[model samples]
Target chain A: MLSEEDRRKGAELLLQAERERKPIPQLSKTFPDIEIEDAYRIQDYWAQARIAAGARVAGHKIGLTSRAMQLASKMTEPDYGRILDDAFYNDGARIPASRFIKPRLEVELAFIMGEDLAGPGVRIYDVLRATEFVVPALEVIDYRTEVPRAITDTIADNAAFGSIVVGGRPVRPFDVDLRWVGATLSQNGIIEETGVSAGIMGHPAAGIAWLVNKLHVVGTGLEKGQIVLAGSFTRPVDITAGDIIQVDYGPLGAIGVSFI
Target chain B: MALDWKTLEAFAEHLENAELERRAITKITDDCPDLSWEEAYAIQDCIRARKVARGVRITGLKMGLTSLAKMTQMGVEDPIHGFITDYGMVPDGGEIAMDALIHPKVEAEVGFVLKRPLSGPGVDIDMVLAATDRIVPAVEVIDSRYRDFRFDLKSVIADNTSAARYVVGSSTTPFAASDLHRLNVVLEKNGSVVAEGVGATVLGHPAASVAMLANMLGRKGEGWEVPAEALILTGGITEAVPVARGDWIDVRYKDFGSVSLHFV
Candidate 1:
């Protein structure tokens, strides 16, 4: 575990890197003794600084829910990150590519909760019942630090979050089978990736159930009216300036954005 | 012809769900064309009972569709009533999240804070003024759960007169019927005055709506009456104007001061 000073330095480095639109060396290299708890503390410190500076905690994002990734990392639990309102954008938004450093996009489902969800034994049914609706979304994940990054580095960097763009048809949690919902990611008129909602830990809301339980250990819980992004179903597609990204969820509708 | 108790419960459930989910659904009247006004009020009561059971405090009641223009436009003779909740209270000059509402519109209104509990079968404007406390400027944010804001009187009544949120001004004035007479009403959006009218447009006197509300309640099942110390919103004075994200709304009541809101 790193010392308090070390965690503060790590958080400052990540925040400065993001502010300057620059990527720093992985924190794991800077603090070889960094622990997962330290990473989260550093992330917390980073979030506190931002919130103190006027950024709001809009919601949360869950990542590393894929079985293959979990097996590769030998982790049994999914990781979480706080979503800042500063990074929120609506569908068909014209985003300036200059705002991010080497940004990439992921296809995911976003659950907007209607009620507070607490942990310890929160079930999938509870998540569904609490969720107001599900909508198609695009998560732009950008690295604030260099690659060859360890879990500590990623966690401290807010799960590599950049921003999120949400649009398309919103359906009630029980309006249709969530697992069967599918979408295709298109970039510059080419279909790059396609995925089913089930790819997110067998069901998109299952990760939220995990998130709520995990938060309970820390005396925290998912707040009412907060958005929760289920982990990506498709691989992150590289994005650059002047790229047009469109994600089609078939009958549910499509979300389109411009990178300029 | 009254519907079964189970049907009322189901309608209440759907209406509440649409509100909580912030999604619009077809009007209930579309499915049941013969749905009576009394049945609509029953469904509304069921919705109110559900809210009360959940511990959501009913702060005040609102009178809607009372303006002569609104009544003529909707072809209605009487104003409809609905209750507001504590969760729906927006502070003066506060921001409202657009995502929390389906499609919101703002109405310039006056809120009557009662000094004493008054009930009536023959409540008149003089009686309403006699029991009054102070009057405050208010902007009622009406958001209908019906798709495209298309709903009959009966449908809207069951949907709580499309009440989503409300803002009460920090300033207040003592009750006087003459003070409300011919007062200039203005609604500004994004720094531009878009709507204007006279305060008397709300059925000659704003207090008249409260009397109407009290009388209507007196005619309801078992004669329901409004309790004392309640803050009641009179019907809209000017036309209700549509609002959206990034829109700054400022409603000025000639002498009652102004209530402003920023949408985000």
Candidate 2:
């Protein structure tokens, strides 16, 4: 366990690292007694502070859901973090490169809720019943932790969510079989990647089920009209200034964007 | 969906120079505030415009909150999504530039090629199985943008899920009546086994993760599209260990061939 003072100092150290772009010695160096859970508490404390500072919580991001990612991070389970309103994007939009520290882009699915969802036992059907619409989206994830973060560091960094883009048409939750949805991702007129929706837990909605059920224990719930990013089907990619990104969802229409 | 560039610039500058204490960031968020969700989205659109203006390709999509434990740890109650660009995708057995990234992590995953189109509402796991044309092994490289890698959710989303590089390994036998959960996965750093795991770590099985993704998209009125080959990375099977330049990483699935990556 970490003392409250250690938690505060840890938060302070994180802020300093962000502001100065300087590295802080590992938490192990400072407290020598810090546990992964303690690190998370400090991170949560800092997150609450950001929220209190008016960072309107938008949704959450899950990481290490894949067995492979878990091994890399040296963790057995998955991790998550929050998203704010400022992180969202729409289709056929332009993103400025100057605004981000080291921005990158990812294609994903975004879920828009139609009704409130709380859990402990929120089944996949419940998620479907409450969902109003769904859109093909892109998630831009960024982090605010020391470089070379461990799983604990990533969890503390809120799963590194940065921005999101939703494009093409909105499909009804009951319109099609989402698990097998297909996509061919092209960049600058070339095929760079391809994927199916089922790659994400057989169906992306199961992530939401996991989210609600997990959050229920924390005394939280997903509200209506909130957009949730299920996770990535393809591996993530890097972006530089002046890059055009387009995703074709076939029947769902298409989404395009560029970075300047 | 445009940012007050000037304000954003000022905030960035403030973030750079401010003390980075809880008090300092709190003061800045209070004083500078963040853009509305709509406004932030506009910024994303603007980025797309910029990309078009330049000539980068738009690649596949990524899921943000796929892990149950992560959601519980972050104090956030829901999951989010993001975008990927063609410029970001790296080929299998390829090298990634170290200078181009602030920090990068790798995740092994399962890739699915679609035989047909799929959409949502009642998309089921069986449907996914029926639609899967092929299954392959893959690796995702994640990096973030915020200085010192610090950001709230919104700022990070605007940055796009810290996407960096990825490599798809060789495909293997399909899950057709097989146990994806029990399959063994060994992660090797420079030809040595650094980590070992199984598919069950990713919410029990990668298929289950895909199932969740389908249902989530269905709620959004969007079903996973047809002919959409997906690399459903079922999150990390083990912890996200760090790597440096000149490091060679390979993920060997018991059923799937090895997927490899190198850093330079």
Candidate 3:
């Protein structure tokens, strides 16, 4: 357990790094005693500070739900973050390249909920029942901390969510087999990666179900009309200025973003 | 025929999702040919409820098609109202993404910030000006979720009058010191003038639009009123100008300076 002072200091470090657009040393290196609970405390402090500064919480995001991601990160658990409204961009938006430390893109699906969901036993069916629709989205990941981060360090940094670009046609969860939904991500007209939604914990909604049950332990739940970016299905793709990213979701439509 | 609450909510979710995802769909009227104005408003109310439930703050209300010219252009005789949320506001000189809209157009108008609550079936321009704290130049970016921006009155109303984003100018002109009816507005795109009109183009006077909105809301019996400190956008004074990526829109108000935006 981290002391209250240490938790605040951890939050301040991450916040300062974000504001300055500079990466700092991992929190795990400085706070060797840091636990998952302490990491969440630090994230909560930083999120509250951002809200105080006039940013609204638009949604929540789940990360590292895939076995591949877990293996790559050397972590066995998923992490979550508060998605702020300022971090949302329209499709084909030219995002400023200077706003991130080391920005990368991940292809994912976003669930827009129609009803509030809470639970210790929330299941895939519950997520489907509560979901209004699923739309294609691009998660902009930025690291505010140095490389070689631990799970505790990543959670404290808001799961590395910099922003999200939402576009494409929305479909009801039952309208299509979400597990088979596939995406082809291209950069500058070159295909970089392709994957199916099943890579997200078997089914995309499964991650949302997991998040709801997890949040129940903290006395919070997913609100009605909130957007949830389920875990990314593909590996992170490096982005650079003047790069145009297009992710085709086949019949679900497509989403694009330009970094400038 | 009366529509059930559940059906109205379903339609609201459908339309709201289109707006949020920046995708276009066929107008609702095409599917429900006999939809009534009351039912349209009900669906709009459902949209407002969903947004509020999602933690979106209601910043104000907006009136669309208040001008006789706009009514004639759209072949509609009455105006429509829609709620504006915090997400709908864009900073001056901000960049609007083209991908977030199906087909977007810009309109020059005046925005009213009220100092007192105004509700009525008998509210007039005098009462509107008396309640107003400041009036600022504004440019509204209207993006219809309907395919090709073609929709009937009922369809457009339920779609929130095609409201997407708006920017309020920094300069606030007092109502008493300015002559709104005679004020000319020039809308320029990329340094070239596109459309120009006087404030009188908006229902004789811009304040008349707000007065009409209050009367309309009061008659609906929804308990909805223009609250104090609410920002009300009067209907467009000029015809809508189409915009695209890399376009810079500048609306110059006669006395209230100007508001500009970029589409990127």
Candidate 4:
């Protein structure tokens, strides 16, 4: 177990590094004495600090859920972190890139809850019963760590959820075969990325089931009215300060954003 | 605070202690400029210790910047990952205040649940199916904590990728009947078609993404033993769009139903 002293010290160190724009060494080198569990302790402290600073906990983001992502990050497992209220955005609007250090965009599906979802024996049917609707969303991913972070380093940081865009077309959970849903991502009127909803774990909501089960193991559950980015279909698009990014979803409609 | 094996059995002990001391002193002391990486880890070590005390269980992890475009934008070749916690889940159709997040963003994605255990190093689509469970619809809300949400890959990873809000719709489909590669997804703003996409775009299929995840972790000797019930997110289907206040974004999965969100 991490002691209060250690938690505070770790947060201070990270805060200091961030303040001075310094880098933290990998746990393997800096503290051969540290363990995965210990690294999470620092993450907890970081979350606490955010909470203490008035950040309201929102939802959780799953990262490195794919093999390609793990290989790129040089890590082997998925990571997660908290979402706060101050970071949320809406549809048909301008998101000033100035609010982000280095912001990137991704197209994804969004889910609305109809009932309560708890962990520990939560079934797919339960998720369906609890869900009220589904829609297209754009996830803005921003990071807080250094460039080219090791898996362990990333774990210490949250999953890098910069902001989110939701509320487009509302599809009934049972009305359509999610696997058949498709999307095309364009930048400056040019297609850059494309894919279908099935790319996100067969059916998009399946990712949420994974998230719920994962959280249940930690004694958590999914509440109503929260937004979960089921996962991405295409590789993320490169977003520039003045780029007009658009994600087209055939029948469900389309969403666009301009970085300024 | 001696650093020895026996004394450091709980390594968190020394780290946490030192951190508290530093925290107390730093408030009064002049901010130390140019702290070393070793020093940063020292503090990280301490925070990890305290988390254990809080009983915050370690859930799964996530990778960021996996997309070629994201990597190029960040000026880095590799992606970054972070951890998810039990306290992060939110409900669909619920009200969310925007004041708590740093710079939040949202996206649409398909979620997968496993029916059996699957590991990496040699896992494939067949493996994903053999171990498949029910599938559902979902949406992810991302929010960064950095000032103006600015940071490099490493810094973002440390900040947990700004993960924030999320909602899963009440819809389930059998994996066998699910045609992931051909699936069509649409994002609507104010009831208008704004974005569209398909499933094949996510590394071929979302299940393939899972196979990759298993294999990646296998190399670390900690690959997922994916039980009969494990949820996995398969990356984004389209590019992320910007949002503002009082907007309603809906994501419709052609055959899987739809989910929506209202930002106030």
Candidate of highest DockQ: 4
Error of 3 at B241 (Å): 55
lDDT string for model 4 (B129-187, tens) is 66767665666666654445445453344344444566666654443424775566776
In model 2 chain B, the worst 10-residue window by lDDT is B19-28
Q: Model 4 over residues A1-260: C-alpha lDDT tens digits?
A: 45557655665665555445455544334444455566666767877887898888776666655434655776655566666777777766788876664577877887777776877766666777788888888888765555665555565655656788875688888877665667777787645688666556556766678778877776777788776777776667657688888777767888888888
- How many residue pairs collide in each prediction? 1, 164, 0, 198
Where does candidate 2 stray beyond 4 Å? A15-36, B1-264
Model 3, span A1-260: residue lDDT tens:
89999999999999999999999999999899999999999999999999999999988999997765677688766889989999999998999978999999999999999999999999999999999999999999999999988989889999999999999999999998887566767677645555567667767898899899989999999999899999887678888899999887767898988999
CAPRI grade, predicted model 4: incorrect
Candidate 3 Cα misplacement greater than 4 A, ranges: B1-264
Interface C-alpha RMSD, model 4? 10.1
Q: Every model's DockQ, to 2 decimals?
A: 0.01, 0.02, 0.01, 0.14
TM-score of structure candidate 4:
0.49
Regions of candidate 4 where Cα sits further than 4 Å from its true position: A1-7, A12-35, A71-77, B1-264
Q: By summed lDDT, which 10 consecutive residues of candidate 3 chain A come out lowest? A: A190-199
Top-scoring candidate (lDDT): 3
Score every model by TM-score: 0.50, 0.49, 0.50, 0.49
State in Å the error of residue A194, model 1.
58
Report the C-alpha lDDT of model 2 over B1-264, residue by residue, as the tens digit. Answer: 144776554544443233122122332223436555444333444555555567876555555545554555577654555545677777778888876765677776665566666666576667777776776677777775555556666555444455566677754555542355554565667765445444554554566555566665566554334326545444565446578999999877654677888899
Local accuracy of candidate 1 as per-residue lDDT tens digits, A1-260: 99999999999999899889999999999899999999999999999999999999988999887664565556777899999999989999999988988799998999999999998899999999999989888999988999867888889999888899999999989987786566767677655555556657767899999999988988999888899999887768889988999887765799999999
